[model samples]
Target: MSAPRPPAPPAKASGLRRHRALLARLAGGPAPEAVILGDSLAAGWPGPDLEAATGCPTLNLGLPGDRVQTTRWRLAALAAFAIRPRLAVTMVGTNSFADGDGETRVIAGLAALLAALRAAWAPPVIVLATVPWRESPPGRSEADRLALNAALADLADREALLLLDCDAALGPDHAAGLEADRLHLNACGYAALSGALAALVRGA
Candidate 1:
């Protein structure tokens, strides 16, 4: 009989990675006490300005094309990391325009994402932050944007999860600060978001 091949190396556990993915420097100074889980807004595309402003030394897991479903799938990978961040902040629903349904369905998907976040990160507290509203200018409807905000607001009552209003951080008054596409945050807008989060977490 052919010699039995050496037993294959045991498979790695779920959420474990044998290789490294790129990590954008999302915050400043030391390693983060917090982590940011969102789409492009949380990712510093323009630059590392937000990371410097927050002074939290964050790991930006923001995927530019991420949506509710993709976030859920990708978030699982964080489970293997040694760090259990002091805070986990997530912003989803901004890219749900193609959801092909009403707000109810979107809200349900968000809820599931939140649940998975809570279960996976096991952060002492999770901030279920709303996505900063996008500016439609002449092409998009304000009403649709409002609906996205509403879907996020619907999760205010979730236990151990705090609902943060992106409005308070970036509202109509802040509209002038947005980027050209009206979707991503510009320097001023991200500064506001990073500053707002710092204040909240500091007080806590």
Candidate 2:
């Protein structure tokens, strides 16, 4: 047998407290208006800027290097807080996209992740398309990423979840949206993303 899986990290106490305070102020107005949930990409999003852009209280529940499986596992922590968001935006699986992880597995994990989120959180989940990455080893290529997005589109349809493309904000090509490293977003990139996502959140 392989090594036992380590325990998942605890939710940030400050974040939970912030959520609770925000929830209390709202008096059951969906606690958090919007929650951005996913890996580093989601983490990089400017939460304050997004709130300003969308005119909603936004919570960032993103953890770096989170795979679909990790996201699924963390649902317990999210649910433990007993906070509900009107909209939850997620963009994950870019790190898990690799030759070793077959396309089928990636799709299944995504599907399961969405299902878990639907069950755990409230309605109006905005599933973000995985963004482009630099030509890094063990990561999926542009073509593969496109394929994954295609599959995700189908998954969104099947589950009746709202699907949005991150590329619109990031840029048409990888070079345009990505920073020098070609993965993370720069200030400009974040602005673009904030605009795109905010529009979606506002139903604009």
Candidate 3:
């Protein structure tokens, strides 16, 4: 009989490695034409599909467990690189919710992040409203998410940013588009999101 497998590394350790790898890739490669930045959704995005769908060389700067404040902090690292992305897609804020932040704080954090991205890259920013997540997360409610999205939309308008209502793409029934965890997207959901984003990228 085999010995019990070693316990897995702490998630924070694994996340650090992933961040380091992404940074090295960004620092070494050709400048990306488009970038997807935010939280896990940004990290989990099918880069090849997005590139294929949008006809852009894309970079994914998403980090798991990233809140709006975390994204704001990470922006400085991306800005340190010489690259200037023509377009940026952001899908964050859910982690902020999960962190027990109220709607006002989450919106403020998002505003700050958008400000930093604009200052750093001077690109057209596409901000996707926070996606629906499962009840297990235990910090946000459907009503709160909708309110957050509405606030984000208003902010986008004032900031002259493009706000994509991801809920619509995910469909009226949220669970159908989500994975077993009911937080992340399934293939069909991703396809729908990518298709919606392709149109915006073309317009940009």
Candidate 4:
């Protein structure tokens, strides 16, 4: 068997509290006008510019290493928080593309996530933020990356979900998106995607 992980650290125990505090502030009270639920990109805080740009309380409920399945599984947790907002933003599953899952599988996972969101809360808008770019390893190429991203765009269209393409915003080829690790975002990259996302929400 694998080694057991250590007990939850203090920060870990208080993590939800921290997240709640942060979100509570963003929400502007017991209820928020909008909430953005996504992956690491969403969790990166997306800068204060978005809040000013949209003029709405935007909560980023993103966590690191969150796959599409985990996001749905965790939705119930958010339900317990008791704040209903007009909109919820969802961005997930770039990891699926990296781990050898095909575009079809990734889109299926995304579809399931959307279904869960639909069942849980009633929001006027559910913006399906398009999966951003981070280069895949050995067997993946730029074309493959483009293909999967393109597939997500199409899926969003068919579902009538708003598409916020971080890849396109970062650059057509994601050339401007990632840091040296080929994953995660630098400040510039984060700003790039957040700028587009903020603009999308503001205009919407």
Candidate 5:
């Protein structure tokens, strides 16, 4: 079967309107010490947990159903606010796999997203979290996920970005940390992820 097409970009006017309040806050609010970007996983991360982990304010810019292209668009909109963060973390690409995108395309997309992030925020340090495990969807498998993550590691090295392996954070018993659908993280998963992320930020 042909690979499923990537997600289409949202209309500019509506997209901007949807995030207007957030943009306003980013523009006006005190600069966050760290900013998290990506899809639902990023959005669902508890703010309290993150703050407690990093010992500072953090802004999460994750949106449900976001793909690499759409995320790039979000970054473009956010550029206007000039939100300067000390550290940035991103966890995306599972949705792309669900969309049936191949590893090459996903990696290229991530590289672009990383470039956009650096150009826009220029954070002192950037963290690229490996795509977490999920139940094998049609046209995807565990092997595919591992291959993509391996590529991501190389990408991080090439880009000089720190790579955070989600599996390592979740530990060997990661299944316990996943939701029933096995796609998104449960509270336990988030706890471990946030703790690892915070440690990285502190050390970076």
Candidate 6:
């Protein structure tokens, strides 16, 4: 068989247009104390919940369907903003798997994103969340997910970033926290995540 197809390139035009207002506000307003970055999971996280959890203004820069590459591009835009967040949380890479990327590429992309984030935001604390469990695509299995998480742990250690295990926060019955599609988190899942994140922010 031919090599698996690569993921579609990010729809930069539409994505940037959609987020233009939010970016402007972020650039114009008082800087947020924390910023969350990722795909749908990060986008859907309630702002009130995050503010309560972190006890500070938090900006969610999540874009649905973003891969690591997409997030890296998105981060470049934030460079124009004079925002200096105290903390930054990232929950990306799952979309990469859905789009047929393997462990090595995903890890490399994540590392690059981290480097870019540091250069752009210079946050005192950076949190790298483990990709949550999800339904495996064809030719992938739970073992692959575990391996990716393990690699993420190594990446976090090497980069001096805190690692949050989303699966552990969701607990052994993680499926209950997942939505019907089994890919994204539901209310219960977000609650768990918010609580865990609060604890981390307090300590950080």
Q: Candidate 2: TM-score?
A: 0.77
C-alpha TM-score for every candidate: 0.73, 0.77, 0.88, 0.77, 0.89, 0.91
Q: Give the clashing residue pairs of candidate 3, or none.
A: none
Candidate 3 lDDT, 11-114, residue by residue in tens: 47776677778889998888998888877877787877778756789888888877776677677777888667778888887766776667777777777777
- Candidate 6 C-alpha lDDT tens digits along 1-204: 123223343576767675676687786778889999888889888888878877888988888878888887777777778678889999888887777777788888888788878888799899999988898977788998898899889998999988888988899998898899998989899899888888877887
lDDT of each: 0.60, 0.65, 0.73, 0.66, 0.81, 0.83
Stretches of candidate 5 exceeding 4 Å from the true structure: 1-18
Name the weakest run of 10 consecutive residues (lDDT summed) in model 2: 1-10
For residues 84-185, write the lDDT of model 5, one tens digit per residue.
Answer: 788888888888888778888888888878888888889978899898888888988899999989988998999988888899999988788899989899
- Please provide, for model 1 over 112-175, each residue's C-alpha lDDT reduced to its tens digit, 9 standing for 90 to 100: 6667666766678666777566655444476876776775665656455666677887766866
Instruction: Report the C-alpha lDDT of model 4 over 1-204, residue by residue, as the tens digit.
Output: 222122121134354565556545644655666777655666775547546534677666776655665565556556665666777778776755666667776777777777767766667677776666666666777677778778878887888877878767788646556767767777777677667766777777
RMSD of each: 10.3, 5.3, 8.4, 6.0, 3.3, 3.4
- Misplaced by over 4 Å in model 3 are 1-11
| Of candidates 4 and 3, the better by lDDT | 3
lDDT of 2 by residue, 166-185 (tens): 66556656567677877787
Q: Pick the candidate with the highest lDDT.
A: 6
Model 6: residues >4 Å from true position, as ranges? Answer: 1-9, 12-14
Candidate 3, residue 103: lDDT: 70
